[model samples]
Target chain A: MIPTLQVFLIVSAALFSAGLLAALSRRHAIFILIGIEMMLAAANLNFIAFWRFNPQSQPPTGVMIAIFSIAIAAAEAAVGLALVIAEF
Target chain B: MSSAAFVLIAILTLAAALAAATLQKLMHATLSFAVALVGVAAFFFLLGAEFVGLVLVFVYIGAVAVLIVFTILLTRRDVGKDRGANWSGALLAVAVFGGLGWAVFKTQSVAIAAPHIRALTVKRIGEALMTSYVWPLQCVGLLLTAALIGALVLVMEEKR
Candidate 1:
C-alpha cells in the first residue's frame, strides 16, 4: 500500500512545474516570491523521497539537508520580503 | 491504503499549488500557497521524516507564510492591482515541465529497490546535528541571524 519512489517523484515534479509556472507568470513581487518558495519545497520533497527510498543504510543526510533548506528558506523569505517592502 | 492517502495528498498539494500560481488576488494566492505548504509538510510526514515534517510546518507555515502576508498588508496600496499572467512565462514553464518529465520517464526503467524503513527519532536527528552536522548547523544559524539583522536594516525608516 505504501507509495513507491516513482509516485513521490512524479508529485514533486508536478509541484515543481506548478511553481515554475507561478514564478514565471506572476507579475506581483510577492506572488513571485511564493512561487520561489514552492520551488524550494518541491526540491525538499525530492530530497526526502530519495532519502526514504535509497537502499543503503546511510546517515540522516537527507533529513539534515531538508532542515537546512527550510532554515535558509525562512531567511530568504524574511530578506526578500523586506526588500520588497523597502522597494515600495 | 497508503497509496490512496498519497494520491489524495498529492491532489490537494497540486490543486493548491495551481491556485496559488493562477489566482489573480494576492491574498488568495498567499492562502493557496499556505495550503500547498501544508500539503508539502504532510508529504514529509508520510515519507516517515517526522522531524523535517514538523520543521516544515513550524518554519514554512508558521513563519514564512505569515511574513509574506505581513509584507503584503504593509504594501497593500502599492500592490493593489493584479496583473494578468504572462504568456511567455507559461510557455517557459511548459517547456521546463516537458523536459523534466521526459528525463524522469527515461530513467524510470532503472529498478531501485525499496529501502527498509527505519525508525527516525528526533533524538537521533538532534545527535546528528550536534555531532557530524555541527559546522553546517552553526553556519545556518549565523546565516539566519545575519538575514534577520539585514532585513531589519533594510526596512528601517530614515528621517529627512
Candidate 2:
C-alpha cells in the first residue's frame, strides 16, 4: 500500500531534525555543509510528497522545483567548499 | 508493499543522516552523507519523479559529494580531530526539532482530499521547462556560471 501524506511529512520532519542536529552539533565546516544539504533534501522531499498527493491535476512543478533545487545546491556546494579551502 | 519500501528507505535515510552528523572521521561522514543522498534519490523514485530522482543521484552523489571529499583532502590539515558533540549545539537542535514536531502535530487535524495519481512523463516536463519555466531556468544557469567563476577566483593563488 502507498504511504499516507502524513507518513511522508513525518519522515521529512525527522530528516530535517537530523539535519539540524548535524548542522548545529558539528564543528567541521564541511560537515556543517552536509547538514545543510540534508535540510535541502528534506525540503525537496516535502515538495515531491505534496506534488504526489495533491488532488488537482497540477503541472510537473514539483519535479521542476526539485531539479532547480538540486542545481542550486550543487552551486552552493562548489562555492562553499571553495570558500572553506580559501580560509584554510 | 510500497509502504514497506518507504519505511525501509526512511530508516536507511535517517540512519545515514545520523551517521553523517555524528561520525568522528570526516571521510566517514562524507560517505554517510552520500548514502543519505542516495536514499533521498530513492525517495524521489518512490514518488514516481524519475527525472528528478536521477538528477539527484547524478548531481548530488556524483558531483557534490566528490567535491566535498576533494575539499576535505585539500584542507586536511585544517580539519581538526572530532571533538564530539557540543551541548549547546545539541540543545539548539532539540529546540528546533521540538518546534517542528509541534507544527506537524498541529497540522494533523486538518483533513485533505485523496490525491489523484497520474503519470508525469519527461516530455511534459521538458515542454514546461522550455516554456513556462524558461526564465527561471536561465536564471539558474546564470547562477551556476557565477558560482563556477566565483569558486575559481576564490581558489586562485596570488602570484608574486
Candidate 3:
C-alpha cells in the first residue's frame, strides 16, 4: 500500500532528529551546516507531502515554495561554505 | 507497489542520514549526506512531482554537494576524524522523535491514504510562477544575487 500522510510525516520527523543529532553532536562546523541543510530538506518534504495529498484549489504553492527553497538553500550553502573556508 | 518503493527509499534515506550524522570521517559524512539528499529526490519523484525531483537533484546534489566537498578540500588543514558522537545528543534526538511520533499517531486525520491526484506538470508550475508568483520569483532572484556577492566578498583574501 502507498504510505499515508502520517507515514511521510514520521519519516520527515526521523530525518529531522537525525539532523539534530548531527548538529548537536559533531564538533565540525561543516557537520553543523550539513545538519541544518538536512533539516531544511525535511521541511521541504513535509511541504511536498501536504501538497500532494490535499485537493488543490489553488496554484502549486508547495512546489513553488520548494523550488524557491532549493534556490535559497543553494545560496545558503555557498555562503556557509565560504564562511567555513574563511574560518578554518 | 508504491508503498514498497516508499519503504525502500525511506530505509535508504534514513540509513544514509544516520551515516551522515554518526560517521567519524568528515569526507564520508559529507558523501552520505549527499546520498540522503538523492533519496529525498527519489521520494519527490515517487510522489509524482517530477519537476521538483529534478530540481532537487540538480540544486542539491549538483550544486550544494559540490560546494560542501570543495569547502572540505579547502579546509583540509586538519580534516581528521571528527570527535566521537555524543550519547546525550543521540538521546535527545530520540526524545524529540518520540514526541513527534506520538503527536503524529494521536492525530487521526493524517492517517488517510493519498487522494488520487493529477501529475504535477512543469507547464503549470511555469505559469503559476509567471503569473501569481512573479513577485516572489523576482525577490528570490535578488536574494540569490545578494547571497552570491556576499559569499564572494566574505571569501576574498584581505590585503596585507
lDDT score of residue A73 within candidate 2: 95
Q: Interface Cα RMSD for all candidates?
A: 1.7, 1.9, 1.3
Native contacts present in each candidate (fraction): 0.80, 0.74, 0.86
Which model, 1 or 3, shows the larger TM-score? 3
Q: Name the better of 2 and 3 by lDDT.
A: 3
Judge candidate 3 at residue B88 and give its lDDT. 94
How far does residue A78 in candidate 3 sit from its true spot (Å)? 0.7
DockQ, candidate no. 1: 0.74
Give stretches of model 3 more than 4 Å off: B158-160
Candidate 1 Cα misplacement greater than 4 A, ranges: B109-113, B157-160
Q: Which candidate ranks first by DockQ, i.e. highest?
A: 3
Local accuracy by lDDT, each model: 0.87, 0.85, 0.90
Q: What DockQ does each listed candidate score?
A: 0.74, 0.69, 0.80
**Tens-digit lDDT track of model 3 for B1-160:** 2889999999999999999999998889989999999999998998778899899999988998888888888888876479878899989999999999999999999998888777688888899999999999999999999999988888885312
Candidate 3, residues A1-88, lDDT tens digits: the string is 7699999999999999999999999889899999999999999998898998887625878888889999898889988888888887
- Mind sharing the TM-score for model 2? 0.94
Give the distance in Å from residue B101's predicted Cα in candidate 3 to where it truly belongs: 0.8
